[model samples]
Target chain A: MSTIGYKDWNVDLADVGAIYPFQGWEVAMTIVGVIFWLGWHIFQVKRESAHLEKAKQLGDHDKVHQTLERY
Target chain B: MEGNLNALTTVFTEFYYWVTVVFMFLIHVGFCMYEVAASRSRNHMHTLMKNVMIIPLVTVTFFFFGWWIYWAFPMFPFFGGLDLEAGAANLPWAETMGTNSSDRITGVFWAAFLLFSWTAASIVSGAVIERIRSSALWVHAVLIGSVFWIIDAAWGWHYGGWMVKYLGYHDAYASGVIHAIAGGYALGVIMVLGPRIGKFAPDGTPRDIPPHNPWLLAIGIFLIYTGFWGFYAACNVPIIAPEVIGGQITGITWTATNIYLAPTTLSAITFNFLMSLSGGLMAAYLVSKGDAFWTFSGGLAGIITASAGNDLYHPIQAMLVGAVGVVIVYKLHFWVEKKFKLDDAVGAVAVHGYSGVVGLIIAGFLLWGAPSSPFEGYATITPWGQAVGAVIMFFVLGFLPGWGVSKLQSKLGVLRIPEEVELQGLDYAEHHAYEDAKAEIIEADKAHLAARAT
Candidate 1:
């Protein structure tokens, strides 16, 4: 039993289409992909916000001045 | 040529592989730059030289016996005897191996595979930088580049390989065949070679050894990405007809095929490659908290992770696979470093080895039940098969040879450079000579100026 519906390559090349596994699940795969893309942005935003908040609290005046001057 | 169409196809195929070979040269260029950038100033020359020398050493040794092993050892000592009939045509003295009017594809095809051999060796070179003796590393380079990795390629990557027939192994882009085995080999050598001095504190906490030049390191990886385009192309047959393939495939439709002669398209792989790279980079950035080195390496790791199934995966599946693999590799790298105290100077083992193992297992599930080859009577792709293939690639072929040779070298007291040399840096002698030359030139210039004033 082949996941791709053909257990062997005995068929004519002209007859073969979509050799990739799970041929009918393109829509589901796309949905999962979209979720991952949107989820990444959400995760990144939250992490960045926390990082910035920590940075805002942890900055020392002298170190900040030195960093600014170096830049 | 028998016909104009046949002549054109042969010429096109020859040119295709030739172009890929030229493009793959950039991978070596990138490795040299990356190694030099990672090494401290005191060791830059030695580091560069160590990697630079792998090209010729591996090339010569590969020519001598490596290419023959691929054809001959596809089933030796396991499923059957050596394929002497097939191997004869690829022998070093074989007329086809050299310039012949009838055979145009041999040189370029050999070069394409030779570049992969160099890459396998280079991956190990990166992990053992700074502390390893150049002589010792060269021996490892020859072994991995010519002997061990090629054996894995014969078993898993070849069209008629036993692994593909029996285990349904499907590493379309060498996630395990090249990257995993090389990475595992690096792990074996490093476990015996030990970490650079001061890499760990008395309390056993690992310290960060930042790259000396981050810009060069960045450019180096980018070049590798560029060369990877060629690598992906090289893995393919470019173009072939079903009649020539002589497999179960029927009809006259000509198509591109993976190493296994399975149907795929360059367009499909292109989409998957870019998506997987993006996934790896994004995940690495988040996981490493935007650390530059890890982020860059993550892009590579991502590609390696998705590569096993990239030939058939949807672009989105490719991306997710890459991202997921990077996260696991990143976490595992640090975990192993802490737990085992194994110092991977450039994360070669995790980025290549662990990523490869993960990609193969993932491909097993994602591409499960897919035909491993276009040939009849082959096993279908399965998670169990891929897992076993990963073990054989990573542990059996990769780690064992590396560890055994390194152990012998260690006992002989030749595996690593002297402790003094490591502390002072591998390029100490060269640095002293450079400084002396500068001082002598400055003194002479001063003397000439004084005479002119007088």
Candidate 2:
């Protein structure tokens, strides 16, 4: 019982399509991946809002001036 | 595999794309250096980090889903549903995506496209510096790099893409697929994100916000030019048989083909690339009155403008076309900035966006009556087709989705940094902690010095 259908290299290469593992689970895996990609955008945007709220109150007049001077 | 000839062809093609990927990586390195140099000193590290992080973020997400989208999405909405048969094997968890002796080409081919992914994100990064939240920018990066641009590639750049087959789309070098979309998306985001403070006077007259280190920006663009040589090579199929391509060319000769299996050559592209670059730089220097940054970026914009037709254009035509496009793009960039009150920090909208649109239109007219595909009965290149192609690229695929998403974020008050924060600069969000630590350490140093003096 191989994780792949066959554990042997004796098979013809033309017959071999996908060779990794968990062969029949591609659809399920893709669903999970889509969730991750979309979820990331939601999470990131929220975290950015929170960070900006804090950043708005963080730096003083001197530091702000220093940043402008760099320009 | 098949016969000895087949084996050699597969291996050679694989190595060709692999080499191109290495060369294309320099484009990102150049972008990082350019952004760091263009940004102010206090904001320098954050700017560099914003561009640098795009590599891993786009790479991982591209591996995860972007590659699959290219295969699955080709005819997805307009022509038909997803091509599930081709896309199944490309799924992230599919064995072929990883190390497998059976599949030799998928890894390298995926990487070539991934490099394009990096370029798309990097183009957006340059436009929204010093003010955009890193987290917000990265979201745009991934969306543009891993998602939106690949969909454009599937629709327009792919061999079986509906745009190629139906609209007779002929973007041989991603003039619209990568560059145009990135530029449009950058424009859309900036429209919602607003200009950096002090970018304009109270009277709405735009001021020139010059690059902090023009020298580094120059070198950065030069490196991009070098990497562009590889990008041009990556767009071609190095060699293939008529049998494999299932095309009508009655020849035993194995030759280099463009993305569509139409005949072209490395020699032809090489001549066009250098001439186009020359045309762009020469025009930029003259147009900008020797302004260093625009002139350098002109070299890049020139290549992008001519890229759509470089596969077929005579070298001089490519040069002339690039030169003409740069002049128009340069003038339009400033005009649009003043008219719309939009601030694009690095001319991403003009260089990549407008040049790409103009390139597509120019190719249509120049290469008119030329077959868009090797396949029989496909539409030929025409002025109307290219104009339609440009609209789809710049507005539908590029701008609309960008505007819609950014609008959502803005409504949530998540699009732009707050007024106080924008005034303070995004760097302070990361720098204040450093300042606190520095203050603590300095107090200790002063005490030690006092003791020693006593």
Candidate 3:
């Protein structure tokens, strides 16, 4: 029932292989990880686009110019 | 002093811990910067000083008693009597406590533990910024850094700790021993000390008191992350042979081990650390809708959540654990703040304390029935044990002592700054001489300019 597969450390160290949790779920974890990575890119693009659109609507030209100058 | 190989191992271990101590100092640096950034400009110097002074105060007090408590109190009271035999060697008058050639490892090892003490105290320092009096906070620092946290460390972090033997409490990197306890301690104090005057609205709605300098706060958290890498390494014995451990393990192989002499690896923790950090950052960004402070803090909370099991967890488990922990912690922080009317100035209680309790319970399920120690006769890791351990850490050792002491301090009218002083700002009230001097100098310069013009 142990997630790391070993219930105890009584076995010899030489016989030990992987000791991480969920030994057979490497492929599933990889898929989950890929989804998170790809999803982040999608979300980030949408967020940036929304921010830029809002920025475009701002009427404070002088403030915008001042910010650019400061940058 | 011994065989050449033994001597080299001893010296190398000493130097290894010394390096980690240096690296861990950044945690305090980060704490000071973070506290100052969180406090308003009027309270900036007071906030910085309050954190900075914990280093020296905790250091001196730790040297006097904290190190001894770690050695002597591992199984004290509940399990057995004080380990006077072990305690004698760590006492302030002991040869090992000094620069004795026979004890090459003691000084550096003590320094490493002392740095942890600083961190425990500093965690509390952040939560009570702006409102707490310097003298009162210093007393709390010594209590947390030198007394209470060390007692818990003796009971759990020590190799012969009762929790390990009796309950299979396996906090490999001090999720409970350090973070949970410190967070709980902070919560206890803040509950008594109360929030900043304007932290809540007239109707008891919690207001978001943003950090005055977000950029500085970001840098501070970044430094804390860097120090955390060293903290992880410090929690491990860099190298040990099976024979040296004298446990169930039988082999010629040398390996890194967690504090309890269980085999783990730097490589393993490294993978989990980065993965968990990434998970926390991503989750926080999504959950907080890219709130910069929560995002930065989420990375921290994520590592803390995975830390208890990082020694054995897969990188993906670490990541998922971190992500889930962040979401829970984020929600809990607000719920507790709103429900209890408690103000945690820097989210210390949630990020460190609640995350620690969650990590411990998660480790219990994930590492269930696993060996808590390489030593025989130790209880196996279990959910019930971990849950109980979390309560003991966050409630008994962390909150109880903190609450009792703070209540006493509050009764004596010394726990918090005066209301007048609080409204005027701590720096202006306490360090008025410095302000007066600055004003006088400015006035003199203006007068000189007028005279020159005449």
Where's the lowest-lDDT run of ten residues in candidate 3 chain B? Answer: B426-435
Which sections of candidate 1 miss by over 4 Å? A58-62, B452-454
Candidate 2 chain B weakest ten by summed lDDT: B246-255
User: Chain B, model 1, TM-score against the native?
Assistant: 0.99
Across all models, the iRMS values in order are 1.4, 21.3, 1.4
A best-first ranking of the candidates according to their TM-score comes to 1, 3, 2
> Clashes in model 3: which pairs?
none
User: Which regions of candidate 3 fall more than 4 Å away from where they truly are?
Assistant: A44-71, B429-432, B439-454
Residue B374, model 3: lDDT of 88
lDDT of candidate 2 at residue B395, scale 0 to 100? 85
Question: What DockQ was computed for model 3?
Answer: 0.64
When summed lDDT is taken over every stretch of 10 residues in candidate 3 chain A, the lowest stretch is A1-10
Better of 1 and 3 by DockQ: 1
List lDDT for all candidates, in order.
Answer: 0.94, 0.85, 0.92
Where model 2 places Cα greater than 4 Å from the true spot, the runs are A1-71, B435-454
In what order do the candidates fall by lDDT, top score first? 1, 3, 2
Winner by lDDT: 1
Better of 1 and 2 by TM-score: 1
